[model samples]
Target: MSAAITDGAVKALISQLGYSSLYPPQEMAVKSGILEYERILVTTPTASGKTLIAMMAILKAVEKGMKAVYLTPLRALASEKYDDLKILEKLDLGGSKIRVTVATTDYDSSGNELAGADVIVLTNEKMDTLFRHNAEWLGNVGIFVSDEVHLIGDRERGPTLEMMLTKIRRNYPQSQVVALSATVANSDEIADWLGCKLVESDWRPTKLVEGVYEYGAVKMSDGSKFKVESSGVSSAVDLAIDSFNGGGQALIFAETRKRAASLAAKAVDGVYKRLDKAARELAAGASADILARGDDSELTKTLAQLVAKGVAFHHKGIIKILTATPTLAAGVNLPARRVVIASILRYDSDYGGSVPISVLEYKQLCGRAGRPKYDAFGEAVIVSERGVNAEELYDHYVLGSPEPLRSQLSNDSAIRFHLLSAIATMPGMKKPEIHDLFAGTLFARQYRSATV
Candidate 1:
């Protein structure tokens, strides 16, 4: 059982919650001395107990009377982790209660408020804003856990995480940073940046079967093929129907909001036929709730109707529902027995045309397929369309490795903002200090020839 390997009090708490064994990656993480000051970068698949590694380190930090911070990429994920960590309040840390608090979009926490809590959860941006404002609580933390650490490669938001990490390592050098990330190709590079031990694994609790759907048949990566009863429907719709007929829920990811809604509406009839009376009533209630939001648009109505039949779609523009989207794939925990990639391309306004999504993004969507303990094996199928061939999709997505995590810290705008914030927040901070700080970033490590 995990209790024999985990900390005593932490073991008791986790055992009380029915968690007794450790996953392979989690066991490697705990054995790597993460709870004893060794920094660690965990790059593994989704639902692989990455968070448990963080929890073990956090409990260790709290046991030692040190504060810990849990940083997430999204507010929703922050809340989810906060709720999960709330159980730590019952952990008898030598008779002291562990104060767990969340600072997200809801309210900004003052230095004193954050300092008082044993564990503080925040979105990366929110945590960065707090640091910019010179929150005193940021300095006292001894453990900093970053979930979805692979986002450091994202251009728009990756810079903030990169800069925040640089600042954290510069300012709070003593803190133990446990970075949890999706499996990336260049995990060693990230570990080098954090100066941490690397733990990478392809182990998953549930088997994952990835493939491509074309001409009403799914060609699996393992060389197996299954005929789908799509009967004139797109491969995406056919896959969903096959999953439902097999008594499993399907999560379909579409590129556009309109396409997502249409697919959901199209899949509803197929999904409804397999639903029993109880499921039908539950789906109907959920659908009514979606419609009650009072958006009389046809898309909303279609979305609601689909939900009534036990199928739903998700996109940023549509109302938040239990469904599929790139955003959902990244931040939320809505799993399905099968995951369908409706499109591999999205309209990029910056490029003025549709562009193929990165391998990392597609992998995240595929990660949404297996629900641990519930599904024996999960299926992730990519639907091929015009201009995109089935063989190409299989090679590019089903068997491709995720892109490496590159720091976005060198952008002129990011440097300008962070430098200004550093000078303003740190008392008597000199130009030399700024130079030294930026020089220590992953950007500096990657581009040794360039001057920060």
Candidate 2:
């Protein structure tokens, strides 16, 4: 109930989206002038109404006859956001219909087809490619939104995203920037880099109960303990079955794809027996759909069988249980009532050994729990394998804060690639211009120097 939400267009948009009132984070965003085109950075837990805040700003931009560009770190995320924004197309604000477009492929073209789009969604790499191609439509974008903006700390893709934001800030100083992120440790530094009003909160619509699974019981952070019936398979499988018995879905994060498939295979019987007639029918349909894809490989057949039993791994379809690798943590908005981490360790090629995941990654996995409007509460459990201390798991992942985000733009290859792109995009750009452009990056801000 802020002044911004009182506007007719805003009210209509909210009602159209079937929301009776803004969540606390959304209200905080509005109070910070998000609808007024203020550059705002929102760092909150998942399912906390971050998308609604971006939608409000997009609506405001469309109202002024200016376009909005929504950027994501992954193509799957881009498609998800595009589908979410498609709802806005039904609204006619000031006699203007919002048109949404997604551009994640075909990097060679200038994206002229997107000129008429009111809202354009693109992955970070795709946006960088569009900038290189000098897409004319980009000039009309009044608002730039970066979903999963916390990926700025990532090693591989961080430099591109960091550079993209820096370029946007430098080239479009008047445009509004709305950065939506998961709860990260160094949110203030990122907000300062973008000159955005930092709105940080831990508020979630559904309560999140984090726990560590050891032996055959779960000890939650809230001082609660529950015994999980032994499935004779694994602790993670037991946790998933417990969730299904309570009329809830579960997402299990495995260390590898093979392990994910193995875990799904093990949980099939438990999950299948719990489904009712209607649920079984739906699962059968999903299984058939998977088989109909024409892959016909042994892996595909195994997956189809798992799907029929209301379980699957790495494959997308309707199922009560899904086991996947950590890649699913950041991509799409697939929530579950319970999230079971099968293993917190993954083999790293760089180190040639298993390494424990960061608290940020753990938070991302746990954030998948608790779907809004569906579950009253969510549970996240980390399974402690033999030789791994349960107390360490509890202290590091369940009770720890995420690490601070640092820039990955200082590397030679990243610098070279971005510098070359800058030179190619702006012909005859001298040293000072290049320096100025990079000076806007988080690397320069954090290091207190742009020495290149």
Candidate 3:
């Protein structure tokens, strides 16, 4: 049966993905010339079906017979999104007709240029490495999706991402670029760089109620509020957890990795408080063997039960979420109903993680707040101590828009070294031809915002 439908281009895309309905943002994004293989930047809330928009654009490009690259910042997010897309592919009418591949940056999966695959899901670094090694194959690259384009504003990772965008354009000059961001202040400057179109909106499906908790009270823009205990700063976290009991996930922003871990461990006090005389007596007498192990597996099982009732943590020690690549959180499928971030915005480590967080890192953590498929609504929040103001965090970092995107030096030895190899292998192709590739990017979008 031919799956061709005349009146419903969107219906076709949604049908292909097994999605029943398209959110307004999703529909608006697709209607914005994604079929033209034009570069676009979509600024929407987390869990607002941004992935669907990216996949929709890629599907159109695939139908036109082209290659597309999907890039994300976290190994966890990359893997998670890749899994979601793969599931959608299984339902694709043209599923078997399209070739799709996924790999991390360190993995050497680009040996054949991914020429056989219509869509390649990988991290930003992996795609950069592929383009650096071979520009010839990328001539077929129609769309380059930069999932967290705001990362280009990151002081550390942003530098690399910035350079990678430059290198990609330097390689596939006409390729359409899709820059997706959740929290950026200056998205238009980035749109102007590649000259395409901009779809910028701060609209979130779930209403986020920002609140500030100090000393003993939790106050929101709305009148409903609560109180934190007076354990100095720890009391603030306790109150946030209490907020979760009523409704809304509390993403506590801690200051250090240790602080994050501390907050995670401490949030379980409610559980501990429940294990009083009767509960403790039952546990002590009910299952000594299960209790003897005293390991994470045991604790996780216990915590999982608590979570089933409605509670959990999102941080490093209890979950190894900070730096581990492939454990469980490698792609961020955190199930916590409330998130507590012990603000690591500024580093305090012996190895010196002393630099203030770049815009990318800030949003990355904040983005974890809302999980669309799971909740009626969720909250993305920030917490600060050391006399640091919550409003200040929101004004400068959390609530502020994303920073503008910029180009890093593309001819850096690593990038140039690889493109040179493709040049040697391609017979006749100048770097300028590659530079022309960016003609379809957000770098060139004229409809960008004037706010920043």
Candidate 4:
């Protein structure tokens, strides 16, 4: 154990959280003086104690009579993190009670209700809106924790996240920043941009085995092989059945919501057949609960029917198999014993045809495999499509490294929106001031100020 972990408050918090000792990543963070206000970027595998590292930093901030803010890209993730951090409210830090709050709606307000909170969790957009509103309480925050920091590469939401970090680093230089991200190829660059120490690791609690499925056989990276009995429906459903028979749950990822729902509907019969009496009764109870909500729409009725048979689509619950679109891969901690990728290609409007998914996206989906404690090893299989070379698919998705993190701030709409936001926030700012503001961004750091 490090000096930071053995300290009084941290040790007590760890005991309360039921952790016997810090994992390797967490231990490395503590050794880097994270609790003493060190800025750090931790890039590690999923379920690798990254959240604990952030929690430790938040605890230190709260103990100092200052506030800590946690930022996520999605509302669902914000809710999940809020629920996780709520446990800290039970701990007494420096004789003051911890107050935790979450804000994901009403971005137009100044969020005065969050003024007294010791720890606040929010979606990235909400935090940006507060900055735009000039929320006075934000100046008192001692630490800012950004979860899933790798999303800065996304085309849709990445610009807002990049601008948020740029503003925080430039405006609040005194505050500590603890960035948490999945393992990416260019994490060192991101760390350099944040001026933080880089803590990268591949260590995970449960081993992950990557594989490719073709012709009813799955070839694993660890030199193992298994034949999935054909359910004559789909390879994904067959893989789900194989996983259930081996006494584990399966999560299948489809390219689209429609495909996910179709696969889940097809999987109901096979999953229900494998369920024991107790599981079947539980599934029926879940189905009844869904019906009790009284949506009565066709989609809800179909989902309720699927739940009764131990299957579901696009939502998390007690079920044997869950099929979801790639959106589920974004920082949602729904781990399973087996993860089957139904398709590696998705339709793209810009390209005017189907395009292969990026290696980073594939890795994100693979991270969901291997339930911690329940499965000794989790399997991630990419199904081979017709006319596509299986060897090529395996080489690119399973064996290749994930893509580097790049900034999307250069997009035309993003540039216009953020520049106007800067003008509105600063009021009477000049061109040089605007240049200086954006020059602090990761995009400017990567491409130089001339581009900005």
Candidate 5:
């Protein structure tokens, strides 16, 4: 209710939720002389009070009677965060006066309108393009929150985020920016872009241990090596099943639907293996077994019989298996005890075959470790077969510091599109200002390194 959040206010918010006091980074965030700040990037490990910090910023704006926009990279992420923010809204203000509205990028916003809300949640593509398309309404926005700010490193999607940030600042110079990101390699650079502060930390409630497992080659420190046990199911599926049996959840990352489905089928195989055979024979049990096992692939049928007893997989194709996954694996909190990567090589070339994953992609997938209540600690073990050289790819990139974030504006088309958006959003702003803002981006930092 106060213009500035007091320690008591902060304490009251945390106490009301029955959560412990804030983390050091969060405490610092709440008190950061934000009015003087234009853009702020909070870089912390997963589950490190990012949502709360984002809320504090939004609430501050709302208290001042200004509408704020929360942007995420994925539609599911937008929904998940929106739903969670709604709970806070109810707790703080009671009744759905509709303080928050979520606009999914892929879906229609027929039921709700973001144009008239205290807060709006949307994916980058939606709000970015929308503001560019309609510049008049940009004047009402007082705050903007960008979640997963580290995504600026993504060559494919980074332009949208960079353009959006530039668009807002150019459109409404007074609007405060709050960019939330996981622990990234270049937080300070991003902070400098928006002319805001950088709050960086490597703190996590849970510790993650990452390693490469060459099927039967390396032991898991206990001298017991994990065999790939290729179930004809993808390695990711196999790993998930192993985790569920060990009383843990897993998040498997797959780029393509086929890969996701194939990997999920493998996990479902393990689920099938665990079902009680006799229970599965009962009509309900049989149906459950059949559903879990999926098709009558002789091997699948046998796997289903095993599943009749208890096991299952998750991916796009296996509807039964998908139930076990986080549709939005990044921000979603369903932690898997063992998270696996199906394909590190994502893009295909007509002549060159497949392109290896960028460091950012690998980090995002690996960050799925230790999903909250599921495990005290999480394991991000890359699975490869014996004598297979794929392990080296991970060792050199994933297990190491990610390749530096790069600037996507290097592409003339990207620069031109951003230039158009900048003209629309921040009319009369000099071209030099656009370059500075874009250069302040993580993309520009990486681009500089590449050229150097």
Candidate 6:
């Protein structure tokens, strides 16, 4: 009900950004005292102003003459946050200017340089490495903003985030933590672990419609079926073509990099046929620019040709185009009118089998459907046939919530690495104290309960 922000510069910036009113999630976050140095975990839908909440807290920290650090899981995301936050550097913070720095890349920054920074953005690994090197400036940090906190569920990078958070919580007990997360099913558990209040919501700025595509028709989650004119073509191509014809961009998530490229190449004919002359020229120029970067390989050319036709596939392999890997989903800003999940199962060599991705992961993919300001509604389509069924996908992905956050600290290698780093960084930290630090981790909490 009340304006949670009281700082003059922050209020002016928010007004300049044209936020006359806060959305439900942002309002809850503010009312929860996130702006008052309370450790808070915000789990909400994308584009719901989580970044704004973090910024308000960061500004609050800077106003108190203390430094803040924004930690992201990916370098690209750190760069994106840096670009957005670097503008604050120009603001006269009551006669003194804020100095924002991005430390995502592998660079050696001295302690004095870091101490002079008002705000610093760094990736999880970069921050962990900084800790290993004992960045003395960390002692003066008053707040830490962690973006994409749900990545704690990831096996590879999850441990890094957990370790970093644990280290920050244990070592920097006086510093406040503002964690930003996607809407996960077990947000309360994560909140409990961090001793922060959970401000969760499913709010979205645009309406999202979920459906399953089969036989040239989409069976929406609401039980409404709409026939897509295939004109003898397959249903998948028809769905994509229809979206483009409706003047909206489409993003397709395939099972593999090869499938993504092949599907993009296949859709080119349909996409090109529907585009007008002006649109075609613009797509061609985009495609030419991609090719000019010059890999000349079949895959690159294949993707370039698709981009030329206003149809493109995204994955880790293809660069310069939109990507939707979990890492990219958090960082990349590409918005599509429709998102088609070509396959739910991705082959994981570690498991030596095809594994279905979690509903949370798929939900993140679906969240990409509508651009905030451009589209009235976004469509998320799941391609169903053969091995994967339509009804099952609808029940699992559409109806199901995200998976709970599980700690990755159980991995011996991860614990060993972090233990060594903690010991090396903390002066004269004894064995029993180190054990206490690990005992306070989410993994310890989960394991202790699982045994009970």
The TM-score measured for candidate 2 stands at 0.96
The TM-scores of all predictions, comma-separated, are: 0.91, 0.96, 0.71, 0.98, 0.77, 0.90
Q: How accurate is candidate 1 locally (lDDT)?
A: 0.80
Candidate 4 lDDT for residue 242: 93
lDDT of 3: 0.56
TM-score of model number 3:
0.71
The full ranking of all candidates by lDDT, starting with the best, is 4, 2, 1, 6, 5, 3
Model 3 lDDT per residue over 1-452, tens place: 12222324445557766666667666667668765676788877666667877887777777667787888777767877777666435534443466677767664454475667667787776766665556455778788888877666543455457656766666567788887877666666677664648887766665655444545665554556665555444653565556454554455555543454455555555444533365455434323433343455855455443332222344222221121111222235553344444443565453476655555555555555555565655544445656777667656664554445543223255335434544653567675554443333333233222210
Q: Rank the candidates by TM-score, best first.
A: 4, 2, 1, 6, 5, 3
Better of 1 and 5 by TM-score: 1
Which pairs clash inside model 2? none
lDDT of 1 by residue, 1-452 (tens): 75336468767766766776778998888778876878999998888888778988998888887889999998878888999899888778677899999988633444456677989999988888788677776667889998988888887788888888988888888999999877677888889889899998999888899998877778997789998886475678777777777767678888877677677667666667777888888888887888887589987787777777777776222111234557777656777889888888888876999899999988888888877888998889888887778898888888888887777866788778877877877879887887788888888888772567
Once superposed on the true structure, which residue ranges of model 1 sit more than 4 Å away at CA?
2-6, 106-112, 231-233, 288-305, 315-322
Q: Write the per-residue lDDT of candidate 4 for residues 341-415, one digit (tens) a residue.
A: 999998898789999999998999999999987999888999998988888998898899989988999889898
Assess the local accuracy of residue 236 in candidate 4 as a C-alpha lDDT between 0 and 100: 87
Once model 6 is optimally superposed onto the true structure by TM-score, how far is the C-alpha of residue 448 displaced, in angstroms? Answer: 1.6
Query: What's the lDDT for candidate 5?
Result: 0.63
The alpha-carbon lDDT assigned to residue 369 of candidate 3 equals 53
lDDT of 5 by residue, 1-452 (tens): 33345644344556665565667667667567544343677888777778888876776676666888889988778888898777546534333343788876643233234567788888888877576556344577788998887777666678888777766766678889888877577666667766778887878767776655554333342334555554664556666666665766666666665555455445554665554545345524544547565675765564443333333333222222232332345566545566666556655554367566666656666677885654688777666644547557556644577555566767777777777766765688796776766654445555663331
- Which segments of candidate 6 are over 4 A away from where they belong? 107-113, 231-237, 288-304, 315-326, 449-452
TM-score of candidate 6 relative to the true fold: 0.90
lDDT of 2 at 363: 94
Candidate 6: clashing pairs of residues: none
